[model samples]
Target: MEIQSTKKLVFLLLFLPIIYTTAQPLIHHHLTILNDKAALLAFKDAITEDSQAVLADWQNSSNVCNFTGVVCNYQQNRVEQLRLNGGGIHGPLSPFLSNLTGLRLLDLSENNLVGPIPPELSSLWRLNELNLFGNLLHGPIPDSLSLLSGLFFIDLKGNHLTGIIPSSILYNCTSLGYIDLSENALHGEIPPEIGNRLLSLMFLQLYSNNLSGKLPPSLSNCTILKWLDVENNSLSGELPTQTVSRWKLLELLLLSNNLFTSHDHNTNLAPFFSALSNCTHLQGIELAGMGLGGQLPTTIDQLGMNLSSIYLQDNQIFGSIPPTIVNLSNLMVLNLSSNLLNGTIPDKIGRLQNLQSLILANNLLIGPIPPSIGQIDRLSQLDLSKNRLSGEVPGNLGNLTLLSDLFLQENKLSGISPSIGRCESLNKLDVSFNRLTAIPKEIFGLTLMENFLNLSHNLINGPLPLELSNMKSVHEIDLSSNSFHGSIFPQLEGCAAARMINLSHNSLEGKLPSMLELPENLESLDISFNSLSGEIPVSLGGSLSLVQLNLSYNDFNGPIPTSGRFTNFTSLSFLGNPHICGSIPGVPVCK
Candidate 1:
């Protein structure tokens, strides 16, 4: 009996050690979870504001992995990611975040966090993504970030960060595929070894910075690059055609608002365009405001089938737009404005079925606007103003029910099309500086024309149509330089939103309409150069917002109101009216 008892004691002792060994992992896991919870609590404490209550779930009793913005690797029993984007949180990022060693992603973008990025983040070697864009963070990018070799994406845009980007970060973060430091105060030239060192880079955005110097020629080595945006910077010098051509996989290239010059002294844009043709996947090209000159290459047709948007405005590009541009059927926006280009718009431009905005304004274009433009049903805004275009406005333009802003002013277009009334979505219509003899009655039907209706500098004659009363949404109305002859219509007050009214240089006769009730927002009123002979309405000076008033060249005989907005006007505003007597200077005192 004694021997059996001793054996049982030995067995019990041996089994106890095995039980303890088996329970060790559970204790370690429990400690790790406790550590994660403590780290999160530290983070929550550092935030000064949490208006969105993004961290409300972070409590001691709650499972750390189940906390808000916290994600965990359940199998490994560790926190893996924290995404608190746009939570309205305000405060500096906590250095205690380094305690979450297992974190692979950390996103706190679009917040109000201020101060420098924590250089201690280098301790997180496993971090794959770190996004803090759209924050109020200020300070230079820390070079210590290069220690994070595993980082694949880093976005620090829209911040107040200053100083040069560290070269070590680009050279050591070889796995980085996307990096955006745009909209910051960063200056200095990009490292020459960027393309050679960071071969995995696919997207690089450094726009809206003070970065200067020519693009690094070594960038040609980044063969897999897709999107490259360096716009709105102080970057100068000629674009290396060889470097540009090497990006065969490139899709979007935005280099606008820079000081880049042509390689051949602005004599030819063909070489630059030819290099871009190598990128078969190119979709959008924005070179506006870049001092680019030379005729647009007819070879623009080779710019790939996926080309959708091309912004070449505010440049020195001259010559006619090549008809081959119509071949890009996928085009959605084509802006060639503020250039020196001249010639008729392509007749086949209607083939671009996807066109939504076609801006060819401020150019030297001539000839009648092609009637084919009406075929683009999707066109929303068309600006062909400040050109030499003549002939009658295309009536088929009314078929574009989606049209909103139509600017055909400063051209020789004559005759107003009645069909324009069919454009229910039209908001702005300016056909001034034309030779129309009659105002299209259909124009008054556009109740949605809220922007303005300028028919000035035209030969429009006959009595003003009463239909003008229906434009309740019109803000500014200028009918100057017309031959209209009639008393001002009292119904014109129905334009409840009128801000500026100019009926000068017209032969309208009879007394000024006394019942005219200008909108409360009215700022300027000019009725000079008319034969209207009557007492100026006393209520006209009561407008609180009126800044300028001109009643000269009229046969009106009355004392101008001495109160309200009338006190601000000078003698010049009442000049050219010999029959007037008022408190205004240069006018005889009312006796």
Candidate 2:
């Protein structure tokens, strides 16, 4: 009996040592192995060749559980997470990462990794989050990614990825809350099955791609979807009018650059725009370049939106400008050009104090210039050309001190308003095809004038104003087909800023101005049908920028200048000048 009791005690003692030996070190080994695999994966995906040195420490570390970007659970030293965000890694993903069976989170985002994602990464059965955004990875998304049953967030934005998104990946990722694949070359239509399958998804971004086809109606089923951006694609179809009513919580709905049109020619956009009223938090609406048609809904005035910008250019909408549009107090740009609308511009248009650009050209608008237009203090560019409007320009236009480009050509304007001179910042001014007999001397006095001053086909008559010398910054002046008379002023040479001057079909009579030497930068000169006399100046050859010169049908009597830069021209320029002689062809030889 004593010997049997001793034997039992010995057996129990032997079993205790066996349990301690296997369980303790094995737990530590599991942690060490998982941690080492994560470090190797990160090091292999570094963005730069120089990153190899930083990752080298991680690669050679004997105790991987203590390495950078690796975290292990206490007591057992088991790796639970690995984060290597913005680590500048460059290379193919290492399959050794699949060895981390115990990982809960793995983030390798914002690296320089390229090539296809490894299917072996799907082995991380316990991973709950994975981010690999801002990389150069290419090729089709791996179908095996659906195996990440526990993943909640997956970001692969700003990459070179292409191909159709896997249906199984969306269907099986039940725990996914966020997914972004923006700024890529991704093709194919968004799967219609997403609405029913991705019930837990709250945010999905697929913007800036070449995606095509019509948007699926089933997308409304995603009741929790807060953000849905699919801009810059070729999708065609009228917007889902009921979607806004269905998803009342939606904060953003970006469907710009898609084919969206109203249903009936008489279909009021009030209903479609009204649907967005429920989503007051909506910040942006980009409908530019959509080729939509129909007049803007008057009901748009009823909604109180905090919109920053509204793009509706390149459309076929036509109607009188709505008066209620003043409701958009924060509006920045109102582009209504290239439309078939006909009516006088609303006097209230000037009420949009925040307006920066007003494009109202190429329309059938008719009326006098509205004085109220001067009320817009922030106006930068105003294009009112190519219309049938008739009236004297408002002097108050000078109030637009910030104005840079002013186009008011091809109209029946009858008089000149000196107030236009107040716009000191004017860069381009065109008032051609009008009945103005003379321009305010101050109009030519702008020191800030840079590009073209076109006063062609007008009734403007009289000598070229000496006040024009004030516009030394002008590049070109076209006063052709007008009654401008008197000799071309030699004082014009003082206006050294002009590059080209045209005064054709005028009755000016005098010798070519000796002051022409002042326009050192002049490239082209035209003074056809004038009574000027004298030889072409040899000083003209000093102009390095001169390209074309015309003095046809004038009473000039002398040999054309044959030296310097003028040697490049032929006798054609001195044609009809019967007394002129030169070595140039078609002209009498001067010995």
Q: Which candidate is the best by lDDT?
A: 1
- How does each model score on TM-score? 0.92, 0.72
Task: Kindly provide the TM-score of model 2 when superposed on the true structure, using C-alpha atoms.
Answer: 0.72
Error of 1 at 311 (Å): 0.8
Q: What is the lDDT of candidate 2?
A: 0.77
Put down candidate 2 lDDT per residue, 184-249, tens digits, no spaces: 888888888877877777788888888888777776777777788887787877766776656666
Clashing pairs in 2: 45-89, 46-88, 46-89, 46-90, 47-88, 47-89, 47-90
**What is the TM-score of candidate 1?**
0.92
lDDT per residue for candidate 1 within 546-586, as digits (tens), equals 89888888888777768777788888888877767777667
Screening candidate 1 with a backbone cut-off below 3 angstroms (N, C-alpha, C), the clashing residue pairs are: none
**How close to the true structure is residue 287 of candidate 2, measured as C-alpha lDDT?**
64
What RMSD, rounded to one decimal, does every model reach?
2.7, 6.3
